[model samples]
Target: MADPRPATPTDLPLIIVAIATCLALVVFTAPLTTLDAMTDALGLSPGAQAWIMSGMPLGAACGLLTAGALGDTLGRRRTFVAGLWLTAASSVAAALSVNGLMLIVMRVVQGLGSAGIMACGLGLLGQVYDGQARRRAAAVWAAALGAGVAVGPLIASGLLAVSGWTATHWAVAAVSAALAVMAMSRLPESDRTGDRVDIGGSVLLIAGLACLMSALIEVRVGSTGLVTALLIGAVVLLGLFWRIERRTGNPILALELFRYPDFSGATLAAFASGAGVLALMSMVPTALVRGMGQSPMSAAVILLAWSGVTVVAALASGRLPERLTPRQRVIGAIAGCGVGQALMLAAGTGTSWAVVLPGLLIAGVSNGILNASLGHEAVQTVPPERAAMGSAANNTARYLGSALGIALISVLIAQKSGAGTDFFDAWHAAVIASTAFSVLGVLAMLVVSRPRGVVR
Candidate 1:
């Protein structure tokens, strides 16, 4: 069949998508370094603090699939522009929040906005570029993801030093507003399916994800009964969503896509990337601050060793020999992350931060490769019209995995610390568990990507 992609023009679309994606991530992670200040200023309880941190991911998890479907159906440019505006408004609301609950709600709204940008922005790129150009564009998108993570904390910390936690939100709001204006003016409209939006499926899926993510976030603090009920609700809601999708003429997410090995492998790899390396890295600053007495800004800088390297690695991944398939790159990178995480076993209370530097750097490279490969597979493995849905599914898995990973790691650490184990010792256990998640991901990807006729 003849290719449908347009001839390459100016790189304006790629540049816009990259910046929007990066900005979305920046908003997502801006609270990481400023958590203490936020907690103090908002008078947050532990539970409220947890919500503040988890709200955005929870919102993203709920909204990504729906946003993708909308983008593909309505118009990618329209959806993307709406997302930017939503993010901007939400940021301003968040900046003005007078309490933890308000802030958490605004953060979730921001996540919803980010979901539109993430899924549709990549989808737009997929529509604009094909073949080698597509590959390189995906690499740049992946690098932008890493770059945002690397810079978010630094920006937050710098702003906090000068003004306060709210300043970070104001800064994000301003940037988001500017991007919204730019996107509306410069971005091209993509072809749309003009199908009816799956209202039933969207509602059910969003509710189910909300229940599931909320359960995960509350696992550390909520009563056991509450968590169990939430889980049950999630299961029931999701099961109904599945049935609805099966019967509906226009489903939000086409389940048949899972039959594609590349798509399935990419999804699993994204989950593993989140549950393993991303989850572990999220906790690094905490371990450094509480266990090693490092200042918040110091910890953020230390983390740059991993996140900064990831940007470089992601950009370089597009240059890898074509003989190496995306599946091979994902599996190898995940395994590499496992090995790098294992290297952190030597860390101890008395050790310098430099002890984990090698492991961080190795994991950084692995993460970079994994990100680029997943981004490519996300758009490549799916039908051209459903590019946004593919990106949504990949990212939904990632955020869900991260939530579960963070909850599990927190439980393990709490258990060990409560039992009088040293903080560093508890951290060691988390490292081991996270590495195990990576190994499991590698195994899962292998099975998913196995040769068609080859049986174990």
Candidate 2:
């Protein structure tokens, strides 16, 4: 097939970047609305379903560990195209899975594909676009991510209204296939730096993350002894990974990057947003369906206020004055998240949509602005040579925070909402935890920066 015309130096390749960003998040969250259907169809226990839910993020974490270095060496365009194809194939496999275990395994592969796509897409944005154009593209990219995440469940809910859950998976596969074709034709290859990745570092980081994630996922379902063992193993592996990075020549992550005040602040803010607002949002669909007794579609409709505002805020963030730096914006957004969660809790346990709409709108706008600037700041704070690495570091922290939040939230819900307790009671517990995280995020933002040259 003929390659499409290469984008000129002035062009940002916004279409491809936006589509990839949107679709990756969409596919990741599409399963949220269909959890009930999946468990029922496959006769899955809670443990199996948890794996299916957490599998993608786990794989994505591993992908983040490797994809940035790969993009530096293999060329961003190639990695991006490869990721799209992998995602498409994985989606198809997920759609065809006959058992819960099979589906969970496919989800893991899909997550890895998604990680490559996001890492390369962001890296390419830094490469091909410059000055205000680059900032604008970052804003749009962030907005697209929020829109996709918001719309994914809505799309699945709508599909489930008329068709089975498998239909949603098929739709994702078709979209991914089209995107792969477009990327292959339109995206230009990045200049290959020929930087060989550290194989040992990659393995250690992945192993550490896997153990940590496994411990979190199995907490509620597995035996107490098993959970304790996994937790200890996770800590040991992660500690070793940290020590190895300090000694390795080409560490997957540059331990010294934390020396930059802006980079440190941005990374902390990203983690906070992921663990607090983003994590809490993940629970909304389930809460709507089970706690409020709304149809999946109806629940999605109610959430439009939250998700829609986020897109608008993200798109507009780049245009904001320089006086309000990304740090200020992120801090404000974290505070908003805390207030929003508080509002939700104060509204009481009723099914009334009116109770939470104000908080959702407030939080949504803040999240939009925060998401738009978080990683852009991180990437821009670093030297140009390490732009991809900077972006990857911020994202790795964000996703790790997300995985932790999800696991903790799930465990709390399972423990609180049982035969004797109300579902809303459990939701209340989750919201409180989320609020605490947001508060911590705000405080961290305040202290995260230490003036570039100040000693830690």
Candidate 3:
């Protein structure tokens, strides 16, 4: 498959990359600012906070699958740009949110839009660029996602530093609006032939996951007994989802796509390693607020350091696949993330903020590299026809792990600490649990690894 698309005077992808794709990442991390504030404002308990926080990702996962289907049906450029518009509109609506419920509702809308951009963005890039240019673009895009998460806190803090928290939302809104407009005019839709839209399975898949997350988030908050029954029902729905998807002609998620050993391992590794990485994202911010006694803005900055290092790593990761063999890099990243998880677990328990700083930076760096490597491997192995689905699958795996990681780590850290419990002890327990999980992730990677250090 030699560059099936037209060879342009300059890369069409370079323009698309410059305009729209990167901003989706920037907006994806935008909600971090609101996570703590909304919890306090809405008077949510811990578990409820986790759900509200994870809601965007849940919506995002569904959105990716559905959006990918639409991109395949309508066109990548159009679908991706439409997503940006939806996200921008949601961000503005979120800024006006009166309660956590409103915010969550807004986030659902935001996720729908974000999913569109995320799913189609990569698909279009796949359609636009080829060979080495495509590889470089994919690596950089993955890195950019890491960078956006890293930079978002810092950017939000700066806005809040001068204007205030509410003002920061407006700033995010402004950025989204700018991107939506540019995406509309500047980018080219995918002209790929033989694409089929998978609609029937997408609805069931999204509804099942949404129900499950809703159950989890609610449990964390109100903990109604019937909510318990609802969760059980959601589990049953998931079982049906698998069965129906198998029978459905066009499933949102193709079960066949999981057959490749390298892709399978990489996706699982991506999920687990992400769980380990986000263990810190969820906990550290809590440590800053609950443990170290920092204000929302100040605490965010402390955590932003991790986000900052990730940015640098993501920006630098394009040369990674070329510099080291893919298998070696993937294994190394898994190990590095494990090390970072151990450090995160330890630092959270320790008193000295300075001691925790190094671990935060390490986690950031590991996160950046891990994301790029997995994303690169996932896209490289799939056929051109399956590329959008591949991208959607990767995004779902990573975000779903993040959602679970938040809940699991939150439970671990809080399990030891009560209202009267020692903060350091709770922090230590969470970090240790996170570290243990990360180490397990490395072992999982080892199972799929080849001796020559190639992922295949």
Candidate 4:
């Protein structure tokens, strides 16, 4: 079929997508500041708390690749609008959750919805914008991501002060509903021809990731038998997924894309960002509140130093000298984040929240650059029609890394806590581990950097 809309302007679509992307991140990070209250109200155990935190990322990891393929094959507008409705409905369900398990399930569903929004939203932008315009749009999308992280805690804190954690969900639900309606009416439709969704590959990939995440969560609870079984299952299922993708005509993830060094570099950067900075930052609120006896609102405000600066830095990234390639920017940004993580070390029980402010601000700037560069690289690395697939692949690595990182951090914290270490000390260990992941990421990127040409 020919294009349904005649020369649609990019501005309106960019606005709608930026809002949806912002809202998705808002939902993802809101729980960070509100975890203590949510835990107390739900009567959650430590294991359950970890699950609630990591569940959404796991779901996104599972759904993003499939969602992207579907969006490209079916219709971007259809997929985007459907994702908004799903998110709105899931927020209401989360608000009504009665227990830890119920809320965890709801969170996973919300993540699936978010996967659709993120994959299709970026795809829509790539469809409408080209060259320098695409770069600017990517930067704007990156800024929206930072803005959401900066604002989510404040929104949650304000609502929690007035009502409770559920109120935040209710507010999210309202905004999501409004966005869905707007998207359905205003967004232009775009879809590629001659591509079919890979049902077998999607099933295998999702199941494998689910098994891996389950094992990670179960390992913390000392369920060695279950963890072992899940790990074995994950290996087998993921191995099968790889085989199927290699053989299938319509693979959900095209293995050929990984041949490009820039693509591989971008994926590595995303994973490192998730596992290192994003994971460490997610735990900061808990540490501030539990370890340092800071109030929830106080923790949120302190985090704003990091997340707020991220927005400014992301918006400003487009202004950086043209000499810096996206890969170079990503490498430098991640390395900067590692340094920031090191600067944040040695926070003992008596340390003030202000001790980490400088580090947070530095890392926030680095994170902004990373986000914008990754957003640009995700689409630029792939064939034009496969922009959604590229976005999905990049995000799959990100959320999967995040799930693993959160689990690892939880395990490290729990081990230290079990050994009678204080919260701050345990957090110090987690920070070190996270920083190590960043270092590894930088090394990997450096290795990929040996190649000289851009993929596109």
**Most accurate candidate by TM-score:** 1
Off by over 4 Å in 3: 1-22, 25-28, 34-52, 161-164, 192-196, 224-227, 321-323, 348-350, 416-421, 449-456
The pairs that clash in candidate 2 are: none
lDDT by residue (tens digit), candidate 1, 31-68: 88898999889899999988988998898889999999
Model 2 lDDT per residue over 1-456, tens place: 111457663453677878888988888788778888988899988889889888888888878757776776678788888888888999899989999999999999998898888888887888777877777778888898888978888888788778888888888789888888887777788787776778888888888888888888888678888888888887888798889889977677888888887888888877877788888877776676676667777877778778888888888887677666666777887898788767776434554657778878888888888887785776688877667677777787788888888777777777755422366777788888888888888888788764332110
Steric collisions counted per model: 0, 0, 5, 0
TM-score of each: 0.95, 0.92, 0.87, 0.93
In candidate 3, what residue range of length 10 has the lowest lDDT sum?
447-456
- Give the TM-score (vs. native) of candidate 4: 0.93
- Give all candidates' CA lDDT scores: 0.88, 0.79, 0.68, 0.85
Error of 2 at 452 (Å): 9.7
**What order do you get sorting by TM-score, best first?**
1, 4, 2, 3
* Model 1 alpha-carbon drift over 4 Å, by segment: 1-9, 418-421, 450-456
RMSD of each: 4.1, 4.4, 4.4, 4.2
Query: At residue 367, what lDDT does model 4 achieve?
Result: 92
Write the candidate numbers in order of decreasing lDDT: 1, 4, 2, 3
Which residue pairs in candidate 1 collide? Answer: none
- Candidate topping lDDT: 1
